[model samples]
Target chain A: MPALVLNNISKRYGDVQALDGINLQIQDGEFCVIVGPSGSGKTTLLNIIAGFTKPDDGEVTVDGKPYNQLSPRDRNIGMVFQDIGLFSHLTVRKNISFGLEIKKSSKKDIDKRVEEIADRLKIRKLLDKKVRLLSGGEAQRVAIGRTLITNPSFFLFDEPLGNLDANLRVEMLTEIKRLHLHLKKTFIYVTHDQEQALSAASRVMIMKDGKALQKGPPREIYNNPIGKFVAEFFGVPSMNLIDGTIIPEEDGSLFQGAGLNVKVKGYSQSKKAEVTLGVRPTDVVVGNQITEDGFGTINSLELLGDKNQIYLTLEQEKSIIAVTSPEVRPELEERVKIKLKENRIFLFDRDQGGRLYP
Target chain B: MSERIKRKGKIPVNIIMLLPTNIIILFLIIIPTILVIWFSLVNFQPTFGINFWQSKFVFLDNYFKILMDDEFVKAVIRTVYISLICLGVEFTIGLLIASILTGNIHGKKILYPLLIIPIMIPPIVIGNNFWLIFSANGPVNQIISIILNTEFKASWFSHPKYAIIPIILSEIWHWYPLTFLILFSGLVNISTSEIRAAKILGATEWQLSWRIKFPKLKGIITIALVIRMMEALKVFDVVHLLTHGGPGTRTQTISFYLFKYGFKYSRISYVSAGAWIILFISLLGFSLALRSVLVERK
Candidate 1:
């Protein structure tokens, strides 16, 4: 059964519509991630789910029952905050057992559960210490443990690792994924870090301007984003986009733009003024060219340990990034031939930013 | 301090920078404290042409007399009771007001500052204001009569049974806003995300306030309490102005009684001794309260 569902969820802050008819569903025990940039409504959606912010209109259902009217306490949802909101005055044990204590559970049960969660989170030793004295990673675990002790059916993590260092972030990312697998509870994690979303989520939902642009598995979303925003938003070294017009030929059509020309599907809709041709950096092959005229001059490179990110400029001053092996980097300011797979190219209406057709 | 410490091969600028503060402490705090201590030990009744240097030393004679005197003990106990009442009522009302202010109320900027008008008013004015308001024909009796559905005109001043009521009201009115402001600051400092997290983890409204926001505001509440208690313990202006510790000295706070002895009767030595006693008791109370607060937090 679907563990959680949101239908027609909408919120407005003054003039800004924070969430516009947001619709979503997650299967039981599925790890779901909503990734977006700042002010993109990712946090707003989480707030609405956590019952912190009331949406202007929406139906939030968990376990096939409407929970919109239920307070967060009655809804029985657990949340790990982005700020790692551990109770500073409370000891780690008390902080973790907060929900249980609120529920009026027996002392033995609270102690046993607290100990179990502490051992699982590797914070057993710190249980007696005040939360104010914890390190960043330790505090995060306490926050998670505090949420986990309740044994809620649904878990919401709002950028739980946002404050961690790079190494700690990667480590905690793996730990969180493992926890998700172990708990097997529905998880809705919101974060702007696309890498975290890709590494942690079973499914990725990309949002922008209070709208869900696309939702799918991480690999599928990365390889087949529905719009210009999703295509640019998911990838590491974002997809390169160049403006072009669909030039109608007698037989079919050709994507003709600044130093770019390619065949595309027939257009049936009203003629769009401009089209954007997008392809990821890795899709741009170097050295062995696919066709003639599929080449450009090497502009510059951002050095990486294994592969250098090559910036190639074609005619009309349009540049694209190409990942080239460090040993195979083309000479600076010299011409290097680059080619792209026809299937790998994406098309979008430049004016509206919506995906144009195949 | 941090900036000074960061400098390399420079003069000890931080210590030098503290010269003004050191001078102020010397003149304002140390000298006054020494004089108070000296006067507490001597019979320094300045009105009799006996300067502080000439007064005979009586040691702990005044201390024993004051402690053993039933009138002084009663005054001390009354002050303690009044202080406790003010602390309780002020904290409760202040917490409630702060909670309401933090909500989605309108015109918070104006309402907050307006709420502090009582605190901004002079203590003497606060005393007189309550006295007028609680007079036989004043608003208090009028409101009371309205509530009781009867005619009522009782002289709050002449009524010894309720003499302290006016002082309590006046003091709470003058000070609750200070508690409100401090608690409001603390309420704001409590991270909303923490509250949200607690809510999602199944904390009811009461639990949210009790467990999450309350603990987060512990330090600030302690600070507010300490400040309010200190101010309440030293309450004299309102009491003196409102009832003059009258209705037969029923509302005489420790400070008011000390004023009676210190300036009214020209018993300066006894007053200084009382002042020293108060300082000792307040210090003991303050440390005991703070220590328990810290330990409870742990």
Candidate 2:
């Protein structure tokens, strides 16, 4: 049985639909990440799960028990807020023991647990320090410890690393992932950064416009996106989408437009239709030799230490990016042959952005 | 050299701009303080048929007399008692009202302006308003008469014990609004995430206030209480207007007692000495409060 389940949850704030019929379930010990842009309702979904928000229409079940009417205190779900939300005036030890104190636990038990959590999070030295005096990374650990000491059935993190610098964010992200692995409790993390979602999440739910657009294992979602948005949203130097039309040929269907003509190898759609051809930068091969696929002048080059990103401008001023080894450095305005892997191309409906070809 | 001279000339322009305010301070505040200190060192009284400058020099005599005066000592005690009672009542009532207003109460928008109305009213008006309400044949007695099935024409101001009640009430009514506003803003300034985090940590409503809200509001509470404490310590207008230190000095605060001796009885040197003592005590209290706040910050 799923550890937590939300069935058709919906919420509206004034004229805006903050969450639209979001249905999700997480198995025990699953690290499910909800990733979206700002205002995409990812935080709202996290708040709803933590019982900080109420859904307009839905049922939230935890271990087969309805938790809709339960208060946040009664729900037994822990959340680390985006701001970390450590009590500024309290010492780190007080913050970590707050939950147990609320439970009226004995001082000995609370002290033992706080010490254990502090040692685990490597913040034992900061136990006596006020939270406001802590550094960003130290505060993050303290926040996690504060929640971890409670040992809730599940944990909700709302962009917990949003305030950290880049280096600290990565370090804390690794710490959170390790903490999750050790605890083996269900964790629902929310973030707007695709890289964090991809690296930390066992499963990723991509949300847009208050709707969960796609959800799957990170590798599965990255390899086979359900729509153009998901495909383009995931990858850094995202997928290049070209306007094209699929034409019926004697041997197979051909995607012909944007100065490229390529065979749609596995596409079964027989009718000639307007579609968007999606290709990852790595799939586009740029070389000196002229090929049947197409050719374009090298527009710009961005060096990335080991590899380079080459921007190619085809006919009609259409631009597409291709990743190539630094050894294959093409000069500015040099005409280069571009070949896209046949099976790697994705065809999306131009109007609705739905994937039309595998 | 010319540029340097022009820059140097700008310095006197700044001094000229400040000259008017400095002059006014000298005449209004500085001169009066010096005169008061000088007067306190002598046994000067305008009724002695001589200018204050020629009065007999009696160093520390006025101070000694004031220290020995039973009425002055009692007034000081009464003032401290009244100030404390007023502060305690105002703080309790203000926090309760502020907490309620911070919640999702209906008509809070309308109630916010209404809450400020008491603070906007002058203390003198507040004093008279309560005086009328607590008079012998006033609405308070009428309500009591209705409740107890008798005339209930007991005098509020004339009775020594009951006289302080109206004075304290007036002070609280005129000032609790300020406290409420400060505390309400402080409560609002507490981040929603902190409250939500506390709730998720299994804190009940009371625990949320006690553990999370109150601790976070420590600085703001100190600020509000300090400001209110200073004003309460010098409480005079309400006592003067309501009871005039009446029922035989029963409601006499230190400020009222000083006013009665200084202005009505023309005991300038004696009152000046008493004022200096009060000033020293107030400075001591203020410095202690300031030190505590600074230590907390550190």
Maximum-DockQ candidate: 2
lDDT of 1 by residue, A1-358 (tens): 7888899899999999899999999999999999999999999899888777788998999878988887777778888888888877688999899889988999999999999999999999999998889999999989889989888888888888889999999988888899988998899999999988888888989999999889999999988788888889898889989888877665556777776667664544444357898888987777743574366888897788888899899889898898867777577888876776666778898978788766
Candidate 1 CAPRI category: medium
Tens-digit per-residue lDDT, B86-163, candidate 2 = 889989999999999988889998998998899898887888899899998899999999999988998998897989
Residue B107 alpha-carbon offset, candidate 2, angstroms: 2.3
DockQ of 1: 0.66
Model 1 agreement with the true structure over B44-101: per-residue lDDT tens digits: 8878888877889889888887888888889989989999999999999999999999
Clashing pairs in 2: none
Please give the lDDT score for candidate 2.
Answer: 0.90
Candidate 1 colliding pairs: none
Model 2 over residues A1-358: C-alpha lDDT tens digits? 9999989999999999999998998999999999999999999888888887889998899999999899999988878888989988899999999999989999999999999999999999999998989999999899899888778989999999999999999999999999899999999999999999999999999999899999899999989999999999998778999999999877768998988999986775558899999999999998866465999899899988899999999998999999988888788999988999888999999999999888
Runs in model 2 with CA error above 4 Å? A244-257, A265-274, A290-292, A315-317, B1-11
